[model samples]
Target: MVTSATQVLFPERIYQCEANIQLIAAHPEQGCYVVTDRTPFHPVSHIWPDHPADRGTVVLESQVHEVVDCLVGAVEQESGQLYVGADIPVKRDEPGWVFVVVHHLAESIESSVGTKATLNVDEQYQLALSRGHSGGHLSSLALNKVLHHDFWRKDASRKDELGHYDFHSYAQTESRVTEDCSTDTYRIGKTLRKRGLNAADMIAALPTIADQINQQLAAWCEAGFPVDMRREGEALTDSRYWRCDLQEGVVVEIPCGGTHVTSLAEYAALRVEFQLINEQELVMITHSQPA
Candidate 1:
């Protein structure tokens, strides 16, 4: 059964942890091992998954095992059953379930069940993904500002921190963040139209909207706004907000659960392009230049 208390080690930085490892099980068919306690690797979240897992290696008993994949694993409360990644049954932060990071080793180590092991995360890849995630957030806010004028009614309510109608959050159907950029898909269906959004007019003015977004992004990057993650607690399930300090003391806050650069100055430039995927769907692709 999954225990009530579990520890995480990635909140500060990704590195190798020299802690004792308990080999919970060995998948003979898959040639992988599962361990408990201490890992600097960040596993992909089962719910609201955006960023991918970290790649790295684990060492035990003089055997170096390449960690080909990392995933989130949960143990059952009553049945003592263990589930990994997409096989997880319940949502994250669910009560009576213990969450652990599972590092999929390339080969089985010589160590026994209770032997000590070390974990080492690939730092270069993690940094790239962090920059991409930050750029993704900035691009989304810029797009919201550019499309602010498309909302026909002032009484429709529900605007973003920048006073836009918040079409990014409201109309978005799926969002994915990659190593270089982020892709967001939105549905411009009847619900959005009923809320006083004119999709046809917005699509016709796509060029102007794109220009506006690019201009805003350029200004933000030039200003070198400070960015940080505000967390409610130190735990894995704690609520976190991505805070960006813009010009004129304006701060934008959005809920997020991912790593990012310390400041906007790290980005040399940022740009976004909009494309119409279908009659009632839109795609926004964000690009970031490394500093």
Candidate 2:
């Protein structure tokens, strides 16, 4: 039976730690996929796959293993078989499964079970990725606020923290975040138009929209609002939230499963540019400089 889900430490901005090796699974190509009792690695989401995995090295018996990639993984309670990202068939928190962080090491070794191990995440790369995530979120909020006045219809489904039409949540189709950069794609199809996005108007004003979003993002970063994640618990399966205080008395909270830096100031500058790749699709490219 599954007694515990892996405790995730990256949400707390932790970089290094020692933990007991829970399981050591073998892969023909990747070599060893190590699961630890606790880890600072932030695995890419199976559901979204937006933020990239954290990479570094883990020391086992004084031999360092290179962590090529990390993944959200799970083990079947009765079978003891592990499944990596997009391979596991069950939904999260399923009764017979345990969610885990799989540290994909480049080389495989035999007989390391229950061994004490030291995990050290690449701090610089992880911090840069964090800045990209936080900056993307900030850019979305700013875009939502700027578009609220003339973009959506009066009968909007959901609103953001600032009481604005949440175009980011409503229309966003896919998002990908990497080191110091993020790309957000939205579908402005007939359904969205019926729900009241001035698609034609927005297309016509792409440059202006980009300029407004960039200006707003620059201001928000300049204000240096704090960035944080609030977890329901330490378990990898627990619900986590991204929190920020954008303006005085205006705190924004989003249900997010990712890592971030201490504050917006960590991102020296943030900017977003918009593009209309097709008549029915919109894209936003965001970039941030680490401080």
Candidate 3:
């Protein structure tokens, strides 16, 4: 096994694990950051930042330190230098660089490297994030279908993972996933206009369109399909995707670099609300919870 950089425990959705601390560093502003040889904590990605960080606790020498945040850290193999979050240079999975999860604490710890450590993930909060992330993906897919049937038929080249008109992919400006909810924002500009998006008519049919999307989500949830993550490798920077088989021969898969629930049963009910701002920006807020 490689020992210089941390290994990410993905495709397992591990909640807690015991690993050795590889490095301990002090940051002037964010307090201290501890790196482990293996971790279950999913850090807030600097590249996307759509889903927030995983907040948990780390035990070092019998002292429990509250991990306020988690972030992606990169190390230079040649220089032995470390860069955290946005400060990191080079794209992820870049050659000659290794990525590690940086657990941020509120204060510094007088610890040394190679110390045995315990990682405890806040299970409830992590579940909430997973729900929101999965719900966001489902909502986007439903929205695409609704728009394709109601507004316009998109060409084959302009389609999403499930072969629906790529409305969300073309117009979405930002997406944020939080506890039991996710918000998606889309900008209706010239590019979207060329793709058959009629801003005025779309704004007028908000209620009807939202109802259609919700109905689709309800049916999918009713099936209680299982979800899984597909990855190319076990490395921290490896390609990962989310896959859900809503029905036989109707599976949906998309590229996602975040966490998700193993089954739709966790989200007994999922719904979305829409709003138009200044006739230019469309906002969608999806709320999900158990029955």
Per-candidate count of clashing residue pairs (backbone under 3 Å): 1, 0, 0
lDDT of 2 by residue, 57-145 (tens): 99988889899999989899788889999899999879889999998989897746788999999998998888888878888888888
Q: Over the stretch 60-173, how does candidate 1's per-residue lDDT look in tens digits?
A: 777778887777777677766668777888776787776667777776555665567787888878777778888888887888777776645544577777777788877898
Worst 10 residues of 3 by lDDT: 1-10
Q: Which digits, one per residue and each the tens of the lDDT, describe model 3 over residues 82-147?
A: 799989988876888889898998889987888889999998898898999999999999898888
Ten contiguous residues with the weakest lDDT in model 2: 1-10
Each model's lDDT: 0.76, 0.86, 0.86
Report the Cα lDDT for residue 251, model 1. 82
**lDDT (Cα) of model 2:** 0.86
Q: Name the TM-score of candidate 2.
A: 0.95
Q: What are the clashing pairs of model 1?
A: 1-80
Which of the predicted structures, 1 or 2, would earn the higher TM-score when compared with the native? 2
Give the TM-score of each candidate: 0.89, 0.95, 0.95
